[model samples]
Target: MPNSTLHPLASLPNLGPRTAWFLDEIGVATEADLRRLGAVDAYRRLKFQFGRQISLNALYALAGAIENRDWRSFNEEEKAQLRAKVEG
Candidate 1:
């Protein structure tokens, strides 16, 4: 159970197989890449890929993944800011 043998993206918070697929499709392949891109920018990329038809839940997932926390753990203010960014 060493970090070196980890499955990379799969080991990150909030990154279920589906979410990981979306992240991969949007060009953020690794945990390092995800952190570098940050949640907001990664969310934007995913939305752009799907023509803005993506759900807000994906944004929440990304926010959580970047912070190494659960998506539902985000505060209302954080969720509100993310929602506004998505809408704008």
Candidate 2:
């Protein structure tokens, strides 16, 4: 069971129970929070909080969730762009 008022992160694309838990741990519990933080910032927070426990794929997932698309939908170029944002 889950709370009705708070939008579940798992309800978004590319996010599952474990990922939702991870986002919650990093203070992102809803779509509004994620939207406010944006994918790059959210991924950065996750990386800072979880370090190597988080992966590059989480960045794609966050972007996909924001765009309402699948994580795999991002082409190589887009992935590279995100990689640059993360590593830059």
Candidate 3:
């Protein structure tokens, strides 16, 4: 049988078993699935389901993983753009 594990997605922080299970329940079992939902929807869903705000740091991590960019190195303008993308 195939390995079946989502290796790349598993590397993201805070994406342990519980979060993974939540994502699966939301029909998002991979990085691509999360990315397809876009940042705003992803955050809203997570917040609503988990009953806690997802932090900017967590957002950065998820975005970085999806876009294959270094989120930590994003400039203020870039960060603003990301925030705008999520908020709008």
Candidate 4:
């Protein structure tokens, strides 16, 4: 079992400790904040803070987290849209 006291962000898929830290640094400290920001916006914010050092996988992971699925769950179309939004 996991620690019940873990931050809500830790409960989401693909958001391992380091990725969670990035989100935390950006003030997305909870699942609700993640949702409110959405994957693209959250990726944008993280990118803005961390520069190009952030992984594209993290963006897909955020999309997966919002949908309560694995990052691999995203289809090509969804991934493309997300890429466009972040890269735009």
**How close is every model to the real structure, measured as TM-score?**
0.78, 0.88, 0.65, 0.85
Q: What TM-score should be assigned to candidate 1?
A: 0.78
lDDT agreement of model 2 with the native:
0.89
Per-residue alpha-carbon lDDT of model 4 for 1-88, expressed as tens digits? 2333466687798887677778888889889999998999999889899987798888999999999899998899988988998888
Query: After superposing candidate 3, which stretches have Cα over 4 Å from the reference?
Result: 1-8, 12-22
* Lowest lDDT 10-residue stretch of candidate 4: 1-10
Error of 2 at 12 (Å): 0.5
Q: Residues 1-88, candidate 2, lDDT per residue (tens digit)?
A: 2333234888899988778888888899889999999999999999999999899999999999999999999999999999999888
By TM-score, the best candidate is: 2
Candidate 1 residues 1-88, lDDT tens each? Answer: 2233334677787776666767778888898898899888888888888865578888898888777789999899999998897677
Q: Rank the candidates by TM-score, best first.
A: 2, 4, 1, 3
RMSD of each: 5.1, 3.0, 4.8, 3.7
Alpha-carbon lDDT, every model: 0.79, 0.89, 0.65, 0.86
Query: Per-residue lDDT of 11-38 in model 3, one digit per residue for the tens?
Result: 6654545555556655777777887896
Model 4's alpha-carbon lDDT is 0.86
Model 2 residue 52 CA deviation (Å) reads 1.4
| Regions of candidate 4 where Cα sits further than 4 Å from its true position | 1-5
